[model samples]
Target: MDPGQGKKAVLNRSCRTNTSFLSFLCVYTIMKWALLSVWDKTGIVDLAQALIQHNFSIMSSGGTGTALAGAGIPFTEVSRYTGFPEMMDGRVKTLHPKVHGGLLGRRQIDDAIMAKYGINRIGLLVVNLYPFERMSRESLPLEKLIEYIDVGGPAMIRAAAKNFKDVAVVVDPSDYPEVVKTLSSNVGFSHEQRLIFAKKAFARTAAYDAAISNHLSNLDNTFPPILTLQFTNGRMLRYGENPHQQAAVYGTTGIAGAEPLQGKQMSYNNYLDVNAGTALLAEFEEPTAVIVKHNNPCGVSVGTDILEAYLSARDVDPVSAYGSVVSLNREVDKKLAEAIDSTFVEVVAAPSFTRDAVEAMRKKENMRVLILPERNTSDEVRTIDGGVLVQRTPAYQENWQVITDRDPTTDEMSALRIAWKVCKHTKSNTIIFADQKRTLGIGAGQMSRVDSAKIAIEKACAPLAGSAVASDAFLPFPDTLEVAAKAGATALVQPGGSIRDDEVIKAANRLNVAMVFTGVRYFRH
Candidate 1:
């Protein structure tokens, strides 16, 4: 055969037949074509073989074609099938009409157009996006990173996804086996399956674009012209904060470290409490433990050992610690596990759990044991009506000025620092009382600072005498100082920027309390 005739023959063999066929039988007897172009070649070979076994032809481009060829699987290149050579450094390979028409052409609505342009309906499309996330993480040149931004991939995916009623779009290799199994059963994909795949495909593209937009926004030193926030739904919780509400957990960069090792399904409240407890515990370098309930830390402490830390923290407010979320900065050992097992905690989060610890935790079937990877210090976001509030995470303070005439003793300073760290994570209008690196009491989310101080004093399980009290914000009046002094609080740490600072200082001096001004307020609402 002549060269031109040979190329036409190959095209006809791979795509649609030029011969006329009755319209009724076209849907069943027409050759099925699967377009495969993916950056992730995880299960492509097996998928291709399965497709070939099901009498479907494979059409791929660039790296996908190379992968199929190397796997000894025959595949028609998109450039060859389209009769258009790839241009612009292989950017224009799959952008041609023939490639898209095969994916988007409708069997019933676009039959005339298909016959006019020799367009073959694509039955399946397997496409995964480029490594934009990985490339953006690397310290690469701008031009280099931009090169990895996929254009044709997203276009093809969207085209196929839009025609999902007649086309199946596969973006995850994990779904390849199911797709193959369906095809093997001679049933192919049902409409529902196609819709599911289409939804995932659209989400994949949306996340990819969001990553690009966020990267550019960071470089421009301004929010993107349109802010695009992307998140992957990590899991479906049992319920939202309340049982009547529906909720799911999502991760911004991926929930790398927050994997549950053993337990029942995590509820929305469990997730919130665990996050709060772990984030607070992450601020400490020593063996620390934090107990959180209703998104507020009830107790926090640092000790020579994990068991001691957990015990000291739990002792602060044993009643509040019941059914709370506990987080440890270090791994959970046998002793710590046994101690935790004694309590009715909803969740326990730590860097790791020893075998003995896991065994002990397993005994508590209702308790959730989470093996946190590493603490993520990303931006904090809260959704409001019709908008979102984004802000940098509060940094841990290491130094504070002692504004009082008398400096805190070394022991008092240690307690003050620990209380300060815990106070930063507490809700606004918060007061924390600590002694010897152990929390004596914590009052959070009160309407008034004075009330918070009173509540802290009332909630103290241990004596407040000689304890250091840390306030989340400046005290507007001397009432809070007087309350703390009456409760035997000897040392105090606060932002100290209120208009009545002079009065507050006078009250502190008269009460014989050593107070320090941090100059920075930590108000968490």
Candidate 2:
């Protein structure tokens, strides 16, 4: 045989013998990759080290790369891997096809495509967007806030999340430990775990976009053509208004005030009742106590002493006050705690609690104790079928116009003012009867104003003589006025914008009831 022929034969034989080995190497070699590009560096070092221990090639960009290098954890720069430097002031770092292809590659379905493009599979993705919400709240310029809006971060997150069947995407640092545990378990992330992460990833991006949209809209108009609201789930309540309905509480800003100190979890009704009590208590600067039941103020009072205020408020209608949420504007002491303990209250909230009060509260293990911060005023949002109504919080009864011939006495005026403030928080067609700055009877959520008046009188059970009455809105007809007069209400306060304002005033004058028009309507529903 010729030498050249012999060499060719030998080479062909060698290739045939190694064919199976090459196929096995291509199909079975375990290659794991983790891409970490995060604005938050929390738990990144430990995660990177764990990935390195599992033989994962860690790829990072910008600050994340710097952090890994400082921590002595080996990582490959994303720019280096993609062979493209970050451009556009570091905005174009990870937008390349190489990065996305690695994240989106399907190991079983798209292996040929990935192999053709020299795309490596990325098994893990850890990314968090820029703090748009935090920066928007700061006094930064609009241009600065716009710059903080993330572009590439959300893109990578969505891409990874789209391929969640094969790729594990983590946006919250709190999930780092679970991710590390799964990777170390040798079985890797299950499909269910990946799906959960993907759901959270989508929600994170949605909330981010909503915040940006709302901030931009606020600059142009208070009532935008299309309203967008973003809320973070604050708590999952034990139940909704009813036990059978599923419920969770979401807040636009967060659960700022109303921090629960002890006791059972809050229910949806409990939250509504607490909000009603707090809103009513906010209207008074003095030591005030408000007892709210079923989203209505059943009792309210203001006094020099906090204990006295609570006792007086509770005494108005102890039957309706049972299982109510009680809120106070002052610190709760041992005496007030003992008094509250006497009742079967659902929740007790105050600005502060003395040591003795906290100790006394421990006796009622099922009663919820909450320490509330000073209330912050924010816009009110109500959801309808497919839309929401946003408006400024109902303004206090600042401008009053006395329509009656007889002006109110000093004590009557004070009581009328308190009743008006409480009426703003009550439901529509509401009537609140009060005297000496204490609520005597409250009838709310009735269909007719006359019924509300009658209910308030019946709830009072005693003669409403000399008590002041507050109507949440205009008296649509004179029947309410007649009912109030017959109930022996000596003074009345209302928004007074009905078509029958003349008739209502005539009835008030005929009954010798001092009526005042606030001009601003507070129709809460």
Candidate 3:
């Protein structure tokens, strides 16, 4: 026998001996290809190294490829593998059929077609979109901002996610360790794991698109034709407003997104009260403290210092301040922390807490302590029967005018301003009675304006004889104004829009009550 013929005969005999072994070899090789193209290069190098250790080949492009090469990791550039040069400033690299076909191709059903097209099956995909949301907030021009909107990344992620049964997709770098762990497992990624990753991947793309849509629409109109909102970083609560309901909190910034630095988990009621308190606290730049209960401002005050503010606020309605969420605009010191901890507070939030202050708070381990940042307001949204309600207020100053014959005194004016700010955050029909430093009494969420005024007078811990009264809306009749005046309120503030405004003003003049009419109404239902 010839030498070459003998070698060929041996190869043919080995192939015929085990057809199952040949099929297994082919399947194993196809399942070891991973494509990683990410805007955030976090943990990519370590993931590539782990994949290499597990005998998987990596394909990458753009910044990801550059990162892998810098790390000395062997990877096939997407441009090289797809036989297509990355054009359009590296935007057209991964949008090719080869990359998507590899991600979307089925294992068994499309095996023949895939072989014919020379498309490799991508068993794993790791991709993250560009920083469109981050850049949209900058002062960049529209053209420059548009460049950060990624095209191919979302496409590949969607394709891989759609075929999650056969392809594993990862959009978050935080999941790299889990992916690596799964690769080392005997069974690899389970079906449940794949499904979870797929769901997260789809959500990521949806949120990215929503951000882009909202930013573009907001450029032209305050309210877009279609409104889109995306809330992430969710935390499950024990229960909602009531024990029978379910609830969760989702946000990335502001009070909605804040987590406790020390203490018990935040409940649904705790979150509502904290959110309300923080919004009210943001109104005063002075050392201010706000305490909220049942989504209403039970006590709010401004003072020369935080300790003084907190003491005045707490004393305004000490009974109602129990188990309330307290928010302070200034840092909490040891003395203020001790004062706050003396009560059964549910949550305490401040811009910062001194080391001694935090240590003092440790005595109340069950009270949540949050480092509250500057509160930012956006368009408010609420749910209705079948749809949602969106409300946006244009930036404007209040048009305040003296509606009564006698103008309010300087002290009364200062107190009226505080009352108006508190009234804007309170529930209507609401009445707020305040002195120069703190709220004396608050009546909120009442059905009748007269009843709210009566309740405010009845609940005052301090004297109402020299306090300023604030009504959230225009009094339809003079009955509410008369009630406030009869309760010893020296001055009053309300939006003057009712048809009986003249009658109310006359009643105020007759009762010797100083009244101011702010053109803007603050009905916070």
Candidate-wise lDDT, in order: 0.85, 0.85, 0.88
Task: Report residue 452 deviation for candidate 1 (angstroms).
Answer: 1.0
Q: Could you report the Cα RMSD, in angstroms, for every candidate shown?
A: 3.2, 6.3, 4.5
Query: Higher lDDT: candidate 2 or 3?
Result: 3
lDDT by residue for model 1 (103-138), tens: 898877898788578776788999998899999999
Clashes per candidate (backbone, < 3 Å):
1, 0, 0
Stretches > 4 Å off in candidate 3? 1-25, 28-31, 139-141, 184-187, 219-221
Assess candidate 3 and give its lDDT.
Answer: 0.88
Instruction: Name the best candidate (by lDDT).
Output: 3
Decoy 1 TM-score against native: 0.92
On residues 1-525, what C-alpha lDDT tens digit does candidate 3 reach at each position? 111233334444544687667566445434367999888998999999999888777888788988988998887888877889999888799888888899898878887677666677888999988999999889799999999999998999999999999999999999999999988885778889999999999999999999999889989997888887889898899999999999999998887888899999989998888989888887898999999999999999999999999999999899999989999999999999999988999999999999999999999999999999657788889989987899988789889999889999999999999999999999999999999998998999999998998888888988888889999999899998788877778899998999989998899889989999999888887
Clash count in backbone of candidate 3 = 0
| TM-score for each predicted model, relative to the true structure | 0.92, 0.86, 0.92
How would you encode candidate 2's per-residue C-alpha lDDT over 1-525 as one tens digit per residue?
Answer: 011233334444544588766445455553577899999899999998888887787888899989988998877778877889989888799998889999888877887677656566898999999999899989798978888899999999999999999999999999999988987898999999999999999999988898888788888886656666666556677787888999888763323335478889877888778877887788789999999888888889988898999898998889988999999999898988999999999999998999999999999998999887666677878889977777785445457989989999998999898889889999988999998768878889999888888888888835688999999998888888788778788999998889989998998889999999988888887
